[model samples]
Structures are given as C-alpha cells and as structure tokens.
Target chain A: MRRLRHYARLLAVQMRTSLTLAVQYRFDFFLEGALALFWLAITLIPLLVVYSRRESVAGWSFPEALVVVGWFSVLKSVLDGGVTPSLNFVVEGVRKGTLDFVLLKPADAQFLVSTARFEPWRILDFLGSIAVLVYAFHRLGHAPRAGDLMVGLALFGVALILLYSLWILVVSVSFRVVKVDNLSYLFISIFDAGRWPIDVFKGALRLIFTVVFPLALMTTYPAQALLGKLTSAHALLAGTGGLAFAAIARFVWKRALRAYTSASS
Target chain B: MIRARKLCKTYRVHRRPPGLLEALRSVVRRRYEEVRALCDVSFDIAPGERVGFLGPNGAGKTTALKILSGLLYPTSGSVTVGDFVPQDRRTEFLHMITLVMGQKQQLLWDLPPAETFAMNRALFDLPRDEADATQKELVDLLEIGPLIGKPTRQLSLGERMKCELVAALLHRPRVLFLDEPTIGLDVSMQARVRDFIRRYNESTGATVLLTSHYMEDVAALCPRVIVIDKGHLVYDGDLRTLARRIRPEKRITMHFSSLPAPGELDRLGNCVARSELQATLAVPAAQVTEAVRAALGRLPISDISVEDPPLEEIMQEFLGGQPANGGVRSA
Candidate 1:
C-alpha cells in the first residue's frame, strides 16, 4: 500500500510536469483539439451516409451507434494519451539502458514503467469523449437510471483495465525482441478494430476480437451497459477476461524483467 | 560494507553481418556469441571506504558497479551490500545507496531540477522538512541554487551534472556508485565534482565506488584502487603500488643549456624524447641515483627532475602487454 502511494506520487509528478510542458506549447494543444474535431467530423460522415440509406445499422439506431463511437473515442484517447507515452518510455529505456535507473529503484517496476510519462495535451481528447457521450445520451431521448450509471461506470472501469492489460502485454514483448520499432504500430492497428461495433464484423473476425484480441470488450460492452443492453453473462465474461489479462500481463512483465541484460552488459 | 564472491555476468549477443543478404540470412540462421562482462570478479570493501574502480574501456568496471548497485543481476556467485542482496533491490537497500551514471540522468528532462527533488522526496517518503534541509545542503554544496529553477534541458552539461549530483545525494545514501561521473565536463568542472564527492564522503562517511577514464579523478578521490582488465581483476591494492609495479623505470627530464651531442644524451639513459637543449630519459628506478649523477656531472644541466611515469603510459603498458585474445586471467 505504501508502494502504491509512491507510485501515485510519481505519477502525479509526471502529470504535473507534462501539464506544464503542454501549457508552454499551448498551440500544440489547440492543434490536437482541432485534429480531433476533424476526425469526429469525418467519422460522422459514415454515420450520416449509413443513416440516410437505412434507419439503423445492424438493428442499432444512429444515436445508439453514436454511443459506441463516443465510447471508442474515449477509449482511444485514454490509450493514446496515457498508455502510448509510457510505451515510448519503455522502448527508449530498454534501448539506452536507462531502464537501469528504474530497475534500481525500490518501487515496483511495472508501476514505474506504466506511469513514467504523461502527455497532458491529449486530455483534450478525453474531454471530447465525455462531451460526445453526453451529446449521444441527449440524442437517444432516454433518461438513464441510477442503476444504469453504476453499471456504465463499472463496465467502463473493466474496459480500461482490459485495455491497460493488453497494452502492457504488447510492450513487454520488447524484452525478448531487440527491434521493437513497429511494436506500437502493431498495438494501434489491433486496437483500431475497436472503432466499430463487433456485430458489424462477421464470423472469424468477431471471434478473434471477442476471444483472442478482446477489442470488443474494450468499448462495445461498456457502451452497451450505458445503452441498457448489457447482459449479466457478458459482464461476467468481461470481468473474468480483465482479471486474466491483468494476471498474464504481470507474468509477462516479470519474465521480461528476468530476461533483461542491461545495455552496458 | 560491500562484498562480492566470484561474481560473474555473461551476455549472449546475437551477431549478424551488415548486408541486405546477411540480414535476410540471419532471419533463418542466427549466430550467437557469449561475452563475459565480469569473470570471477571478487572484492570486499569496508564501510566508508573510497575505492577507485580502474580499467580500460570494456574492462567490466561499469558492469561491476551495476551489480553492486542492483541494476544487473550477476550470472554466478554472490554480492551483498550490508545485509541486503543487491539483486533483491529492497527498499532499505535502495535507501542506503545511489548510482549516478554520467552518461544517463535521473532528472526529469522537461522539469526543473527542483521538481525532481520534490518528486524524489515523495518517492523516498522523507519528512518534508528533512527533505528540504537535505536539498538545501546539496544545492548549496554543488552551488547550483540558480540552476535548480530552470528546466533541466536549458542547463549546460556542467550545470546539469551539478544538479544531477544534488538529485543523487539528497537522500543521503551511505553507498555511492559513480560511473564516469565526470565524463563530459570541463577540467575545472570535473575538479569541482571530484571535490564535492570527496567532501560528501568525508562529511557523511559514505562508501564510494568510482569508475572513470580520468586518472586525475582517481588520484584525487580514491586512496585504494581495484584494477580490472578485460573482465578480470588484474591488480587490487594501493594505486601507488600498481603504478610502481607497471612502470618500475623513473622518468628523468633534463633541460640543457645547449643542445647535447647525440652520444652524450644516449650515455645518460634510454632517450625517451629529444629536442633542442632538452631531453627526457627513462631510467630504471634502481639506477636513478647513478643516472642523475652522470647527467649532472657530464652535461651542462640547467634543471633536472625524476618522477614516476604518467599514469596513461602505465595503463597503456598494462593493457597492451597482455595477450590479444586472452580473457581476464588473475594477475
């Protein structure tokens, strides 16, 4: 518990420094917000084109699909904003042996690696996500019950854990592979599949996303909980998957640390 | 206190020739070679002892320091700092030691040095007043009070290094592992860091294990020396003893009033260097008195002095005289 407090303090430092840096380069933050707006605009084009042709997509209404997109946007923002920066830290740390400093510290290495960096400007996307989710709820014309809010939060927490776990598993591969130049690319590409509803994907791809990749649980299930369509069985499965992935991530991290031969050596 | 018993670390590196075809071939048939970074290296250092870890490049000086600092796990044998196993990296062990790598930094690049100090204060769980007091002492010692507020990226190399020292020493660790701590600093800056390190050791009774290519740093700070070459302990004892053993001949530099005849200077000793009205000779330590008498008696010597050879020469002879392909065998 004391170690956890240390991790939190270190993360707070990273967040504060990153925020200060972002404020110094305020134009970058505006540029990122503009880019996000542009992306949202372009993404809405498909929704409009599809909604004009039909009333719903795969038995889901336009606003219902918007919730999925909003959830995905929020998830993407969290991954890109929070987790991706640390991915760069991990790769550079391994390549330059700067990881030695982290390893020598008394804190848990996994916590240190995961929270070593933050890009505060990317929080714009996080805010944008919340805005879109709110707007989508308004469009749906349904007042969400308190139980709905609780389930949405619970599922959202599970989704975040699953995403964090998957990212850790991917980055941990750098320990065995020297040239992880395209590792982040692989992660983003796999995560890209989460942008759309899994029901739109058929057969093998759906199975892969649901079982192997678990991209479906990252955004789709939580959005479903908010939409009042989440089944208890699916929630159980997502929870179990999140726990299993977290366990596997911890195992991989330990194995990778064991395999580490510092750059000087 | 620190102790290591036959501590060894070996790395298996994959080797591939540099070519498109070789790159493709390597994918199918990879080759591996083993490098022994530390081979049966054993040493014991008492508490508060300052030891210079000396060697040529790639001689495993940094490897041994890493092992001692808990950064690298040794392949064999044992290493202990106080009652803690270094590889375990316990909180108490971490609180007791600090490893400062000159080539790398622990300071947050985009943040001010003061921010790193604050972050460390929280991470180390220090009382606020105590942390602040220690920071003030270190900043004043390093004379980096002005540099602490600016972003670390804005500071010059020397300035950043001073702040680096402040960051490392704020915890007041009992054992310090400094690897090339003066690598890229100016001469005066190097001297300042050396002085600061010496002072810190004196004031706190901290054990210091320092590695550097600069012999001056070793001469200035460390009393006893441990020399390793090609991953093996070659000489371990007093620095003066090693220097005397490597080059038993003394250097005799004499300034002549006029250019000496070729035969005249040769008669003094082996001519190491010759110039107009000046010459330097390498005379055996045993014959220094006789050689000095001959030079003073026969030549118009304006000035003459005898001293041990330069440390660079001593190290060169020690490394170059060894077998080319030989691994570090015990001296």
Candidate 2:
C-alpha cells in the first residue's frame, strides 16, 4: 500500500511534467487532435464502401460494426495518446541510453519509463472516441442500460490494462534486443485486426485472435458488453485472461530488468 | 558506502564485420563474441570518501560504476551500496544513491528543467518544502538561475550539464556515481563544476565515485584514484601515489625574458617543451633542488615554478600504446 501511494505520487508529478512538455508543442497538439479524426475516417471509409452493397459481414450488421469501430477507436486513441507516448519512451530510452537515469530513480523503472514523457493533449482523442461510440449506439437504435454500461466500463478497463501489459511485454524485449525499437509497429499492425469482429474469422485464425494474440478482447469483448450480448461466464473468462496476460507481462518486465545491461558500459 | 567483490561483467555481443555479405549472412547465421568488460574488479569506498575511478576507454570503469549503481547486474560477483545489495535495487537502496551519466541526460527534452526537478522531487519522495529548498540551493550553487525555466533543448551543452547536475543532486543522494560529469565543458565551466562537486561532497559528506577522462577533474576533486586497464585493477591508492609511481619527476617551467639557446635547458633537465619566452624541463624527483639551483644560478631566468607533471601525461605513459591486457593482473 505504501508503494502504491509512492507510485501514485510519482505518476502525479509525471503527469505535470508531461503537461508542461505538451504545452511546448501547442501546434502539434492541435495536429494530434485533428489526426485522431483523420485516422477514424480512414479506418471507416473502406468499411463504408463495403457496407454500401452488403448489409453485414458474418452476422454483424453495419451499425454493429460501428459499435466495434467505437470500441476500436477508444482503445486505439487511448493507446496512441496516453500509453503510446510512454511506450515510445521505453523504446527510445533503451536506444538512446537515457533509460539509465530512469533505472536509477527510486520508483518502479517500468512505470517511470512509460510515464516519463507524453502528450496529454492526446486525451482529446479519447473524448472524440466517446462521441463516436454514442453516435454509433444512436444509429443502432439501442442504448445500453446503466448496469450494462457499468459492466462495459469494467470490461473496457480490463481491456485497457491488457493492452498496456502487452505493450510492456513487447517493449521489455528491448533489454535483450536493443534495436527492436521498431517493434511498436508490430503492435499497431496486430492491433489493427481488432477493428473487425472476431466472429468473422474461423478455425485457427479465429482461435489465434480470440486467444493467442488476444486482439479481439481489446475491443470485441467491451463492445459485446455494451450490446448486452455478453454472458457472465464469457466476461469472467475474458477478465481472467486479461489478468493472466498482465501477469506474463509483469514477469517479462522483471526478467528484462535483470538483463538490462545498461549502455555505456 | 559502496563495495564490490570480484565483480565480473561479460557481454555476449553479436558481431559482424564490415561488408554487405556479412550483414546479409548474419541474418541467417549470427556470430557472438564474449567480451569481458569487468574481470575480478574489486574496490571499497568508505563513507564520505571521494574516489576517482580512472581507466583508458573501455577499461571497465563504467561497467564497474553501472554495477555499483544498480543499473547493471554483475555476471558473477556481489556489489553493495550503503546497506543494500545493488542488484536487488530496493527502494531504499535507490533512494539513497544517484548516478549521473554525462553523455545521457535525465531532464525532459522539451520541458523546462524545473519540471524534471518537480518529477524527481516526487520520485525521490522528498517533502515539498525540503525538495524545493534543495532545488533552490543547487540552482544557486551552479548559478543556473535562468536556465531552469527554459526548455532543455535550447540550453547549451555546458548549461545543460549544469542543469543535469542539479537534477541528479536534488535528491541529496548519499552515494553519487558520476560518469564523466564534466565532459565537453569549457575550462572555466569545468572548474566551476569541479568546485560544485567538491562543495557538495563537503557539505553532505556523500560518498562519490567519479570517472572522467579529464585528469584535471580527478586531480582537483579526488585524493584517491582506482585505475583499471583491460578489465584489471592495476592501481588503487592515493592519487599522488599513482602519479609518483608512474612518473615521479617534477616539471620545472621557466619564463625567460629572451629565448634561451636550444641546448641550454638539456643540461638542466629533459626539455619537455621550449618556446621564446617559456620552457618546461622535466627534472628527476631527487634532482629538483639541484636543477632549480643550477638554473637559477646559471641561466638568465626571469621566473620559474616547479610542479608535478600533468596527470594526463602520467596516464598516457601508464595506458599508452599497449593493447589492453585483456586479462592481466587478477584484481
């Protein structure tokens, strides 16, 4: 509990530092906000062209697809905004040898590296995603009940944690493979698969997305809860899976710290 | 406050020689080389002691420092800073120590150094008042009053180095591992940084282990030095002793009103350098009195001063052309 408080305080200060930095690139701040919308358009335009002729893909209606897009946008924006900057910190810090400073600090090194630099203005992307999600529900002519929305929020929280954990696991590989800074591209590309419904894939590919890579859980699970299509057993299973992935990420990070072999030695 | 016992660090580095073929072949069949960065290197620094860790480039001084600072785990040995094992990196252990690497900075690049200070204050868990006071004191000492508010990217290298020192010292760390803290600074800035380090040590009684290629920095601040060459601890003793051991002769520099004959200084001692108004002669340790007396008595010298040969000269002789003894003296 004491350690938790210490981390909380550390994160508060990090947030302030990040805000100060974000203020420096005021023009870039607006550009990121604009870029978020541009990203959503580019992602949805192709699907719109497909929906013009066909009503749905694999039983997921176009409006339901919008729900998936909503969840996708939220997760992507949050990842690109708050957590992506920090994850890049890990990659850049590892490449630049600057991480030696982070490791020397009293706080948890992983947390410090992730939160050490950011553009908090990207929170605008998060807000925009909420508006998109609401509009999509309006188009579907159905709004989730308060209790179901709460459950969706909880599931979304787990999914967000799971995404961060996965990124941490990827970034942790930097200790052994210092040149793997570009591995973040792999993360985003795989995460792109989450833009579609998991039910569309079949056999081995379906199994991979739902379980191995776990991209579907990052969006589909949360979308299901909002649609009131989620079962208690499936929700519990997804929550357990998220926890297990988080544990693996933590373990990987610990191993990476042991293998750090900081630069300039 | 810091101790290392037979600490060894061996890195398995992937190797590929120049050429596209090697690069392309490496994709399928990579080569690995085991390089011993630190081999049986052992040293102990008592509380409040300032020791200069010296070595030629890639001589394991930095590897040893990383091991001591909890940044790198030694392959097969133990390291402890204060009361905790360094590799364990316990919060108490981390809070009690700091490592400043001159080549890399801790300050947020786009943010003002003040932000980093604020972040460090919380990270180190110092109370607000105490943290602010320490920050003020360090800023004043370094005379970095105006630089703190500006983006760190805009600051000059010298200015950035000063701010870096402030950030590193804000925690009032008990053990400081400084790696090339004064690198690339001007002579005056170098002197100022050296003075600041000395003052900080004096006031807080923090144990400092510093490594710098600038011998002047080590000579001015550290009384003791530990030198490693090719991952071997060749000398660990008083700074003066290392200088005396390697080059015991004193240099006598005289400024003449007029140029002296070329051979005139040869008789007094080995002429290290000669010019119109100034000449430096390296005289044997025992013959310093005789040489000064003879020069004063015979030569038309205007002013003369005697001093030890520069530390760089001693280091050059000690670690000069010979290939590093990859595995020389065993500690």
Q: What C-alpha lDDT, on a 0 to 100 scale, does residue B150 get in candidate 1?
A: 96
True contacts kept of each: 0.48, 0.87
Q: Give the TM-score of candidate 2.
A: 0.95
Clash count for each candidate, listed in order shown: 0, 0
State the lDDT of candidate 2 residue by residue for B52-160, as single tens digits. Answer: 9888788888888888888888889888788899878788888888888888888878878888888888888888999899999999999999989998999999999
lDDT of 1 by residue, B88-147 (tens): 879999999999989999888877888888877866778789999999998888888888
How high is the TM-score of chain B in model 2? 0.94
- Tens-digit lDDT string for candidate 1 (A1-265): 9767767777786677667766666788788767866765665567678788888777778888888888888888888778888888888888888888788666788887888777766677778877888888999998566887788888788888888888887778887785586978988888877867888889999999998889888888888888889898998898899888889989988877877766772
Task: Report the number of the highest-DockQ candidate.
Answer: 2
Q: Which 10 successive residues of model 2 chain A have the least lDDT summed? A: A116-125
Candidate 2 — what's its lDDT? 0.84
Which pairs clash in the backbone of model 2?
A: none
